[model samples]
Target: MTDSGQFNSELMAFLDASPTPFHAVQSMQQRLQQAGFVRLDESQPWQLQPAGRYFTTRNGSSLIAFVRGTAALPEGGLRLIGAHTDSPCLMIKPHADLYAHGYHQLSVEVYGGALLNPWFDRDLSIAGRIVVSADGQLRSRLIDFKRPMAVIPSLAIHLDREANSDRTINPQNDIKPILLQGGDSSLQAIIAEQFMAADEQLVDYELSLYDCAGATLSGADSQFISSARLDNLLSCFVGLQSLLASDASHTAVLVCNDHEEVGSVSAVGADGPFLQAVLGRICGDQLDSALATSLLLSCDNAHALHPNFPAVHDAAHLPQLNGGPVIKTNVKQRYASNALGAALVKQLAGRCGVPLQSFVARNDMGCGSTIGPISAAKLGVNTLDIGIPQLAMHSARELTGASDPLRLVTLLTAFINSVAPLCVIAD
Candidate 1:
């Protein structure tokens, strides 16, 4: 119900607050709690009622929220939206502190297909979940350095004459980020300083380096948005906004999973049982019937046509920033959208008076995938892959059209709140 400008302002604030997946879900929980949503525990018996809005979390990274719609079960089934919270970044390795030539650095491994060179000469900080010894077992808490704590400086061009054109980065040798220059430096000691702990030891951690400059509107007319983790966090926030504003007739659900950037195979990933378990409990004996009519809107960011490299995308299917949301497709099933699902999306866009676009990677180029295929295969539900087009997908910072996010949220709100069932759509 909010205007686009107001929605975008809040979206940027959400991006700034969620530096890591753990922080992302926490922000989501806080927003949903403020919207009159109650928290549900996986270990407890769920007594969902009509008109109730509730949510649950796992591994402090993934989240699932649902609203019992005004309609009865089997009449409309579940309207689902899915996205991932994690993005490509460098994660600190165990015993990461390393000192050489009076400089202190931390050992890190690339989390996904990240652009290695852009990571250099940029401000970086650490954030993620930490486990400390509590009473007897371990307890977890999220932390953010929230300051420029590290950088991966490029080798001087003077040292290598062809450094500009002939650059080769070794992950093992060159990608280690410099934290500080000093002696007797310890990564654990730095992390311990952030903990409000007494008689507690840092046992386990999953921290990743992030850009601290945060999000802002860019471009000549300030029509572009630049930020870290926009690959899917943009979708997560858009889906959240849509769900909050939706007035659907059927049950509605929103899931923001972790580990999509890393193949979505972990306990909290889409490849696992998280969605299935929740759906099983929600529908109980009606699981089969509910799934037959359910639809999953797998939301993620699409690759926009880069002016410098337009051939990277299919000529006819090129998507543009600010155009609107895209219905992504792949002949390889890498993206799960089909004719039936596409029709449903187009119809909803028409009903909402929003423009729509499509994206297909160049035939010779390998296409990236989303959680769409995984969830469809797991639950036997029809799935549609859609997203707002953006540039610099795996870079520390990415860009998108300033208006596209709110536009997508408007379309999604229609999809989730639609009165008609999407079960047997005509092509």
Candidate 2:
């Protein structure tokens, strides 16, 4: 077992380094390479062997890492864990430069279902992938300013007496971050300067603004973690750690897809063919038989019961922070957890001695969804939705119990190494 403090310390480092999905995938790739996992290119032919560990990526944003076990594919099947790499934030637009009233700003569009209010009055930085033309060829590069470069200052109360009561943000005009009071540099020039490539021509880019603050332990007793993108990054880190600690006796796969926050419709998203294509190549002729015995655990942060908003949660199904991992369920299939899937997780948690909790939205309120339903539908695999409890899910900064992350990792590692049958026959 890993120390909770050590695990959290590393997780904080990961969060700080990964300001965007491209960065997150890059960070995970480094760790996977260090662990002796060979990288596979999708465009090339794969010569996979049993008991080999390998990883692959799509669009430099999503990643899939797997360990082929010594066991047969049709018998043990794949123990797959899924999470999303993308989060809600402000994305930089194509023509981002905006100069108004002697102030240079960058126009940004809201990405995903972000809580716009929290974005105001925050020190932000930009980081993402940029395509540049150099030496008569196009190349992609990842860049992070790694410092406070801009801010979205809120208007004072004097400007509007109802600023706090009836304030509404106009994504188009209100959220443009001020870059400098008076600057002659364009967005392209700034990016080129960062790369020290004055001769390179900027072709296209995908950039996003992120909070300058790093992840840290908070609360009176330091029981909570506060950071940006915890909605799904927390799950991504947990899944990665669990895969690293597995015994490798059974086939285990960890897939962190991009664009789940925006309905996952992209080519590299869970709704696409990324995972399916990889699985088909791995299972070959035994794909159908393997899927029949396979199980997927879709890990995403669950809404914790907020003290101030206790009435918003279902009375009996309220999940608490620091309690344990949550098994999310929705009768409408918003979540993919069924009785059989939930029972398997319960069994695994019980064997690992990890506490478990349940979460279901109040009858009147609508529930949020995760990659569970999407992956389950796409792969025809039994899937369960589970995660650590968190608060202020879509805010610029989110919170989760510091202890729950380690507990969730412990339970998932057990699932990955388990020799028990993954399937249960229904009467």
**Best-matching candidate per lDDT:** 2
lDDT of 1 by residue, 1-427 (tens): 5577777788899999999999999999999999999999999999988788889999889999988887866778789999999999999998799998889999999998898888999899988888898678888899998899999998888897998888888999998888888779688888897774767888989999998888998988989999998988999999998889867467889999999989999899999999999988778898888878878999999988999998677899989999999999998999999988898889999998889899988889898999999999999999999999999989999999998888898899998888878777456
lDDT of 2 by residue, 1-427 (tens): 5799999999999999999999999999999999889999999999988778899999999999999888998899899999999999999999999999999999999999999999988899999999999899999999999999999998888988998789888899899999989877799888888874777999999999999999999999999999999988889999999998877788899999999999999899999999999998888999999999989999999999999989999899989999999999999999999999899889999988899999998889998999999999998999999999999999999999999999999999999999998988777
Q: Tell me the RMSD of model 2 versus the true structure.
A: 0.9
Model 1 residue runs over 4 Å out of place are 134-137, 425-427
The TM-score of predicted model 1 comes to: 0.97
In lDDT terms, how accurate is model 1? 0.90
Question: In model 2, what are the clashing residue pairs, if there are any?
Answer: none
Error at 245, model 2, angstroms: 1.5
> Deviation in angstroms for 404 in model 1?
0.6
Give the Å shift of residue 200 in candidate 1: 2.1
lDDT, candidate 1, residue 296? 92
